[model samples]
Target: MAEGFLRPSNGRMEDEGNKYFNDLLANSFFQYVKRNECEIVTSCKMHDLALQVSKSEALNLEEGSAVDGASHIRHLNLVSRGDDEAALTAVDAKKLRTVFSMVDVLNGPWKFKSLRTLKLRRSDITELPDSICKLRHLRYLDVSDTAIRALPESITKLYHLETLRFTDCKSLEKLPQKVRNLVSLRHLHFDDPKLVPAEVRLLTRLQTLLIFAVGPDHMVEELGCLKELRGALKICKLEQVRDREEAEKAELSGKTMNRLFASLAHKQGTVLSMIFWRVVCAIRQKW
Candidate 1:
């Protein structure tokens, strides 16, 4: 278990001084415990447990000493109040297996050769680097409650990914067409009220889908193609169904997708802002 607080030395700064920093430290300690044999975990011992702070202050003063080689560390989490440029620069993501949470990903060439999973919850992140497509081993990603607008076509390269949650990505318009290539995906959550994209039916392995809509009818034809979704599909609008036969067929067979709510309408711009926010809130509560 992570300690509630880390007491600082020199009677200097209290953990209360920076809540985000303290939280990161506590989480890092727990991570170290999970991966005890890793060398970087050993180095976390140098700083006084109570007085210990972030590694950015401890090992970043020198250049060649760290940020490279056998002493190199991975699985980092620096979700402070602002952009964590220090953490971004210090660790090599290509060798990383996990990252707790980060804000912006709009810096330098993000070349994560072997990265498997990344989480950026409750951060200020607005856009993803097109370079994100380079991670051949990536399997999981979460970018909830951020300002991101859309995913790049390059995202199709993550063929191995299984879960992707873009909940509360309010500004997102549509998913990239290449999304269909993620044949391995099992769960997906995107809060866009736009028509469910036609590309989704291609992900034959998908089981759980949380979707918002511009009008469910917009992609009704494509929805019929998803024969593999055996779990549930929580959609924003049920009124989009123009074909009663399709709905009835699936329901009668007892194999139809589960609907969270039965109806929705298509109206964009600020005039529909109230409805949009209401549906978004409902999705969050359900999730």
Candidate 2:
């Protein structure tokens, strides 16, 4: 984890981080698994000898007597095997800052006031407690790969949130109408294309919008206002756009978007010709 060691100040710093990873690979500190000619390193395993050394060093650095429980733990990761809800509910991590739950169920009267990041990936949580809105200091919230059908309207009260990720949550149909109130949001990753609100244009600070579906209320031209968007962008339901002039008004060339995909709900050559293909060509050349 290059968290504190690497600060991405520019492109060169990112390259340096990659170079450091490669150096570890070359030294056999990290092993690669190959499929065909492609090699992908999914995880790093510590050698038994190395693990012993690290454990001894950690013990040496320990300054205080062992606590009775995890009451002082600031970061908690709960990986549920089965029926671990009772164990999870018993935790009294009052000073917690980060909580990562890779579980199927999360039952909570959760009251972590200082919590900043909460990740509940692949969880079976159908709904979040209204108490979540009380975490004013929260910044990163991820509820991806879950069965949550809807978010409580009180979620709009998190004014300090910077990243809100709900990718692959197929059951989620819509976002709160007042989602525009999250003025600090910089990244919003969602699955349902139609869930995007017409007021998305007000999120001028947004940078990573995964998908945008053009509809009667949210026109293609609304994308033009998101000048800060970069990386990949998928524009679905292109059949709704009237003509090429309207598509061009999205101003794809003005931003730093590298990968662009445009899809039509229905195959209409005239609409595709006027809006879709031309936009793709413009993006291909711009990047």
Candidate 3:
């Protein structure tokens, strides 16, 4: 996704770029590929041979030690046990393009001005700096399995952001309120069922949302806006649905999905039947 950032962004490069990534993996360039329940590659470990081939360009900074080419480093891997940022003051941040941190705690000012991809999965970080809005060139961000509670509102201003992930963030309950501002988002991989923000339906280009929790504020009908949704989708709070009319507005008949799960009302009623009908229609069109 980071390499897909091109001039005159028409948004087709990401799909093309993903193909290259898949091919490289098939050719044994990468290993330990991690995927979510919906089969999205959340992370990967570069093969040792491949790492040696790109060693000059990438730097695996352990504990921010003074490396030989710290000034020219573009890709950095924080392999320290977690905390301590004392030795990193000399490393320039303007030229950094990617950062993968295994640190348990991330400190210091968020100053990666030119960073493109950031992966902090399983980190102990609790919050993001408001200064993260400075990453204008960022295209991919993953904070899966972290302890962060919320994303700073400044994140919504990243119009060029293509992929934003918070999968398995048990403490992070919801996405930023103005998520509609991410006009270029393609995939939103998360674990929370109720992470839907206001005007999420506006993201018609979105292709991945494995869990859809229907809250009173955001009804089931909003699913109609995501015509491209595929794979598995679990709908919680189906009882809040008003009636068959509201459920019908979801337009799930044409959606090609492998699985669609919903919690219908416990008691038999019109709402229960309505929920059941929608689920059946969705299943019939499974991909």
Candidate 4:
């Protein structure tokens, strides 16, 4: 392991042998968790640091004394707006793994075996920890309204995840390459043009596939591949104006996009007719 360096909030680096701030951080981390719930283990260190301590004395101590294993931490939310330290300090995520946060929550491979759902919407998080993929029992993951740019390659490990929402994740650029492994996903939502790469055709089990910048001319053929689509899909593009040529191409692709809708509309029935009409209107530039 690399030696711990004392990097303070003022953007200055201290000596690696500086045990003063290091011990201060350890104490502050422990005190922060104690002040919050006193029943969970939380820390403000980066995932690397948190993971290090999580596997070492700090987390083990918390597990033994604060909470009985990972069973007590049922809900966790780190602060949405703060310096890295403040955000890290707010995270008391310990044994009770079923968690909800708008912060970067996955500090380490989820050790809690009973965790089933995780919600981290609007937390300004950027990357998902690869350790998250270890949660085989996870059923829900919401990362809406955050600045998250992409998912980890290991995301396909969540075999039990059913509802995955990424609403308003403006910076997200691509889905995990292993997304095909998410055969259990029922809802996949995003509205960033960068997020809708052609690889999206892999999600065959998606019921609600929301995208940005869907045009009649842009891979309408791929829409037919999502055979499990049973709910409404919304396509959004910001600031770009729609023209007649775009409308015509969408009208042509509308035949297929609408057919995909027909399969889904059958299950949802008239409730979706209006929604599909709105979708068609958006694609056709009638909006």
Top lDDT model? 3
As for candidate 2, its clashing pairs are none
Candidate 4 wrong stretches, greater than 4 Å: 1-97, 108-110, 212-218, 235-287
User: Model 2: per-residue lDDT, tens digit, 143-231?
Assistant: 99989998888888998787899989989888888888888787888877877865899988788788998887788788889887776
Q: For every candidate structure, what is the RMSD over all alpha carbons to the true structure, in angstroms?
A: 13.1, 6.0, 3.5, 17.9
Using TM-score as the measure, which candidate wins? 3
Q: Which window of 10 residues has the lowest lDDT sum in candidate 1?
A: 34-43
At residue 64, give the lDDT of candidate 3: 39
What does candidate 3 score on TM?
0.81
The residue-level lDDT of candidate 3 at 84 comes to 33
All models: lDDT? 0.56, 0.70, 0.74, 0.53
Query: In model 3, which range of ten residues has the least summed lDDT?
Result: 82-91
Listed in order, each prediction's TM-score against the native is 0.59, 0.74, 0.81, 0.49
RMSD of 4: 17.9
Per-residue lDDT tens digits for candidate 4, residues 32-143, read: 3221222212344444545565543222222113333423334444333433233223334344445555446566433545566677787757888877777777777888
Candidate 1 deviant stretches above 4 angstroms: 1-72, 88-92, 212-221, 230-232, 249-253, 256-259, 264-287
Total clashing residue pairs per candidate? Answer: 3, 0, 0, 11
State the local distance difference test value for candidate 2.
Answer: 0.70
- Candidate 3 — number of clashing residue pairs? 0
